[model samples]
Structure formats: structure tokens, C-alpha cells
Target: MSEAFGSVLWLIVAIGILVTFHEFGHFWVARRCGVKVLRFSVGFGKPLWSRKDRHGTEFAIAAIPLGGYVKMLDEAEYEVPAAQLGQAFNRKPIWQRIAIVAAGPIANLILCVALLWVMFLIGKPDYSATLGPTQGLAAQAGLRDGDRLERIDGRSTETAMDALQVLMLAAIDHRDVAIQASDANGHEVQRKLALSRLPADFDQQNLEKAIGLVWHFQVAPATVGTVTPDSASAGLLQSGDQITAIDGQAVRYWNDIAPLVKQWGERGGEAMVEVDRQGERLALLMQPRQQLNPDTKQQAWVLGITPAPRKAPEHDALRRYGPLEAIPAAFRQTGRMASDSLAMMRRMLTGEASAKSISGAITIAQVANATAQQGPATFIFFLALLSLSLAILNLLPIPVLDGGHLLYYLIELVKGSPLSERSMVAGQYIGLALLAGLMGLAFYNDILRLVT
Candidate 1:
């Protein structure tokens, strides 16, 4: 299947699963608390399929797979019958009503924890801090190939990639990054180095010259892993031929050669490729097919050759844990993620983080698809994180959410009575407007990302 179609399919699955679980939480909790749940729905809009249970709750699968909801028997809108008043959400004690409203988000949180625990048991790919030298300007700056960076500006490096990112960000600002390192000599050293930045007309050659660091991991040479029967790559290159160079440039590594091949498509001419087959260097002249990088808005070449898989380092491979250990670790990881997300949200609100980083449905869909591709364990972990986010967001005491309901309950507790119906309705409308505005902004950002 096409990647785009696959992405859409995965997105549907993700939303469907998450929404179902979320609504189910409310249904289960309300039923347990003696509150009558009128409906438990997966998705919104018109119901595609629905069935009424003995308890009078309609369980449904709706037409829209974007979101779902749970409806409770409450007098918030209509008057409750005296016979069923005991089971009305609004007639319940403040605490019980609060529990019924809060259960949905709490269910999401619980799902996240369970998924995370399972993910930890299944394992995940990891990497250590390692750096390789890039050709051109960076190599000239006393940075040697195969040099593992230890630190930058006196900050200890957790990974070599982190150190390089600092340098790249500094380069973007035309500033020098102070690097502290342990070279081949095993002696610690430090240097303030300036990075080369690409001009406005940044191409492959200049891009390579500007930032000069490479990944330490080894990737197989550009060889056909899978070929579309009549694709450009299949027509010109064979599966077993090891790609040696693109154009006339010597391809030192897989990363070095791939972009060059992609550039061939933009040039719209014959690309001179050097391939090694059992020690024989064969030159193949091939034309690149034009393609667009949807996310980047850049034109590029297409060969349709999947590169060979790279081996993950032992330390980077997934590690399984005992059931006893997994529980605590899962809780710790979940807490940390929750805390970090809250911090980031606060930072975004305060303008400490760039608003451009605020992502919407597009970003969420992309992440969900990517995580699902990694396997069930990884997908589950992502779902968990998203669940936690949902739980936290709903608990913000904003009207139109569970937290808003809780806030009303709290006011009832303090004032010895519920807020006036008109006041409650006004708050709900205000909250809905605020949420709509936020959604609009997020969607706008998503479109900007797609177009740009």
C-alpha cells in the first residue's frame, strides 16, 4: 500500500481504539457509581451501529471515527423523573458526580500505564552517543572522523547527537558552540568552534559543507531492498549491486550517497552511478524521477530502492524486564512523561517555547502512524502517552471538559448550592468557544507545516 494510505489507516485505528477506551471508562465508572449512563459511543455524529442494553444504555459505533462521547442521565439539561432521580448524575452527591465525570480521563491514564508496562516488557530500540565526521568544512575544524564527543560548553553529553544538535542550533544563529571533549588521547579538552552555515540557495553540496557531523552507526550501502516492478531504480540498478558513488563523487557511507542519488532526480539528467559487485566497479548512467518531499516542500529524485537495514547496537536493542520490576518502572516513566508534558505546555503558554512547535491532528496522525510501524509494543506506548495527555488536559478546570464539571461541583460544595443554570450554560459556551479557537489555531499550524 502507498505510505499515505497506510498512514490514514493507522490514524483511524489509533483514534478508534483510544476513543472507545476513553468512553468506556466513563460508562463503567458511572454504572459502578449508580449513575445511569444513557449512551457509550465510539466516534461521534450518526451512529453506524447501536444496541440498547437491559440497563437502557445505548452502546454504539458512530459514523465519524474522530472522537467519541459518553452521555449520562443528568438534570443539567432536562428535568429528571422522580422515579429515576436516584440514578440521575445531577442528583448524586457532589463527590459521586465528580467521580463519574472524572472517570473517562482517569481511564485513559490507566490505559497508558498498562500499555507502557507492556511496551517495557516487549523492549525498544535505543542508541548511544556516537559521532562520525562529515566531509568539507566541519572536518577542517579540528573535528576528526570517528571522534566521539563527550561534552559541550562543560555540559556532559548523554548522547553524541545531543552535542551535535547544540552545535547545529548555534550554527543557525551564526554563533560558535563551545565543545568540551575527550579525544583519542583520553584527555579532556575544550574548544569554541564556529560552524559553516548554508546560503539561501542551499543544495546538497553546500548542506554537506555547512554541517559536518555524521551518525556513528553503520548502514548498508545503497542497494535495492525492494523494487517496484517497473520503477526507475529497477530499470537501471540491480538488487545485488552495491552503490559506490553518486555522479562523480566518492560515496564514503550510505548517508553520503543517498542524497546525491536524490539530487539526480532534481537535475533531470543522466546520473553517473558507480557500483561495486564482487570487487568490480561498474558505472551506470541513470535518470532520476522527480518527486516531492511532502513535509519539506522540496523537489527531489526518486530511485525507489530501500536501503539495507542497519544493525542496532546491543545497548540500543530492546530489553525485557520481570513483571515485578516492570510495574514500578512503568509508573516512573509515566510520571516523568506526564511531568515533562505539563512543563512543556506551561512553557508554550509563557512563550518560552516556540508557538510554531504547537502541533495538531496532522502531527498526532504522523506520530501515531510512525509508532504503529515500529510494532504493537511501541504503538501501545504512544497510545499511553496520548492518553495521559488527554487525562491531564480534561482536568484543567475549563468548562466543556470533565475538569469544568468538577469545578462546578467544587463551587457547589463551597457555596452550599449549585451555580445558577444560566451561569453554568454561559461558562460552557465560553469554554466551547475557547476550545474551538485553540483547535482552529492548531489546524492552521498543521496546514502551514504541510504546505511549507
Candidate 2:
């Protein structure tokens, strides 16, 4: 299947499942609250398939895959018959109404937590910082080499990998990251370091292209693992030879060699590579090959040498947690993920992150396809995360969204009456406009990424 088609299929499935579950939450809650639900849909527009349930609620699958909604028998729109008055949505107690409105987001959060727990139980491979050289590049502002990072920008980190994630998120748009480091002696120091500014072509919505900085601890040794046939590195570098330097500059590790090679390509020049074969030093002149990464649409250089995997400390094979422990761990992990996502959103809003990050249906489809290819576990995890995001977004106080409706209901509760019809109509129009504008921007970004 074509990548685009695969992406769309997965996206449709992912969105369909999440939306159906979300609408189900509202439907279930409303029934419990004695409200008459008119329709429970899995998507928008004209219904392709539908059935009236035993309770007289029309359950449907619509033509559009965008989203779904629940229609309730609201008294504001029509007079409620005496017998059916008790089943009208507006007739329900405020608390009951609130519960119905809140169910959808809660359902999403529940999915996130459950998926995370399963992921933890299955266990994901984690790289340790201990595999790196005991000494390397410092933060340059105040952090010293050999100092282990404890936190980044005030976010507590359990592993070195988490710290790197925090740093990358803060680095978007050249933001300064506050890092806390500790030495063997247990002394801790905090310092703020500014990230290198993004290139002009960088897009914030496309995360893979926005932050390209390599983590300090992730550098591999400058030893070739495999050499492709008829490639640049095949005839020049041997598998066992240690790369000592590039272009006369000393290369202590795999990380050191990569930047030099990339720079050579960017500068459109040749580089001299020095290697240590046994005890004799050998030099080779190389010209980096520049090519566009079709996936990212960005220029990258290749020398055709794949680095050996970093040796990890032998740990007991993946450990599974008990049910009780898994629950809390899942909640904590999901909360952290949500917070990190929110931080990225804030950066995008402030223009600290590139606008390219505002992806449309195309990008989402691509992500879905890629995730699907990673196997069931990975795809389930992706669905959980996306469901959580969708739930959270729907709760936002913007009109035309679930959150917006909740916001209006809250106002009604506070004022002891619904907003004037004219006011509600105006808010609806405004919400529609905002939604349209955002979709336009996302589509435009998608097009730019496709063309450029």
C-alpha cells in the first residue's frame, strides 16, 4: 500500500475508535442521568448507517471521519411533553448534567492510563547513560563534564533519557533550558543554557525536523558496524578501524564524527578522516554526500557507515509490575506525558516553536501509519496518547467543542440560567470561525511540507 493510503486508513481507524468511545461516554452518562439522547454518532455529516436502540437513541456512523456527537432532548429548543419532561437534558439537576458533560474526557483519561499500564507491564527497551564515556562535552555555560544531569528546566527526571526529552522540548525556538546537574560528591548546581536557534525552514508541527540536537550521552564510538556496498564509506573505512579524527579535528567518539561529516556536507567541501588501525594512523579524504531525506524533506549528509549499537549494562530481563503498582505508575507516566504535550502546545502558541508543528490530517495519517507498522503494542500506545490528547482538547473552553459546551453550562450554573440565545449563536459562529482558521493553517502547513 502507498504510504499516504496506509496513513489515512490507520488515522481513520484511530480516530474512529477514540471518537466512538468518547461519544459512548456521553451517551451512557446521559442515560443514567435520565436524559433522553436523540442521537449518538461515531462521525459527522449524513449518517451512512444507523439504528434506533432500545432506548430510542439513534446510534450512527456518519460519512465524515472528523468527529462524532451526542444529541440530547434539550428543552430550550422544543417544548417537553409532560410525560417526557423528566427525561429532558435541561431538566436534569446541574450536578447530573455536569457529570454527563465530564464523562467523555474522563473516558479518554481512563484509556490513557490503561494503555500506559499495559505498556509498562510489557516493558519497553530503555538505554542507560552509564554506557557513555565517563567524560564528554559539558553544557558550556556552567555544567561540567562528568556531571550527571538530574533535571531539566525544573522537571524532575527519573532517567537520563527523560532529561534529554525535557531539554529537546525546551530547545524549540532557541529557548533557554534550566538544567540541574550533580557530581559524584552529591553537590548539585543549576544552570540555564540557550539552545541553538532553529533554521528558517524548520516547522514546529513537524517534530522530527524541529529539534535536531543530539544528546550528550547518546554518542556512539567511532567504529563502523556495517558498510553498504558501492557506498562512500565502503572503500574508505574498515569495520574494525577506529575513527580518530575528521578533517584534522580529533573525533573521540561516534557523536564527534557525525557533526564533522554533516558540517562538511553543509559547507559543500571535502573532509579528511584520520583512523587508527591497530597501531598505525591512516588518513582518508572524503566528500560527504548531500541528499534530501524524503520523509522529513530536509537536507542530510551520509557517509554510509552505520555505527555499532551502544553496549548496555546487563540488567535483569524486563520486569513486570503487579496490578496495584502498575496502576499508579501508569497514572504517573500518563500525567507526565500530558504535561509534556501541554508544554509543547504552549511553546507553539508563543511562537517559540515553529508553526510547521501545526500538522493537518496528512501528518496525523503519516504518524498513524508509522505507528501501525511498529506492531500492535506500539500502535495501541499511539492510540492511547492520541485519545488522551483529543479528550483534553475537547475540554478546552473554546466554543463548538465539548469543553466549550461545559464552559457555557458552568456559566449557566453560575447565573442560574442559560446565556441569551443571541449570545450563544454568536459564540457558535466565533467557534466555527476559529475551528476553520485552525484547520486552514494545518492544511497549509501540510501542503508546504509536501511541496518543499
In terms of TM-score, which candidate is strongest? Answer: 2
- Estimate, for each residue in 1-452, the C-alpha lDDT of model 1 and write its tens digit: 66677777878887887778788888888898899888888888999999999999998999888989988888876888989999988777888888878888888888888888888788755444454545554565566555556776555454544454455344444555666665656666555565534343233222334565564554344554566556566776666677878888877556675578666655677868888876788887777676676878976666667665555434443545778889997897788678767766775676544456567888788888887877787788778878888888888888998889889999999999999989999999999998898888889988997897
Candidate 1, superposed: residue stretches over 4 Å from native: 134-316
Which sections of candidate 2 miss by over 4 Å?
A: 46-48, 76-81, 126-150, 153-161, 168-212, 216-320, 346-353
Candidate whose lDDT is highest: 2
TM-scores, all models, native as reference = 0.68, 0.72
Scored by Cα lDDT, where does model 1 land?
0.72
Q: How accurate locally is residue 423 in candidate 1, as Cα lDDT from 0 to 100?
A: 93
> Model 2, 130-213: lDDT tens per residue?
223332113345554345666777777656557656765755746667767775466877766645544544444443224333
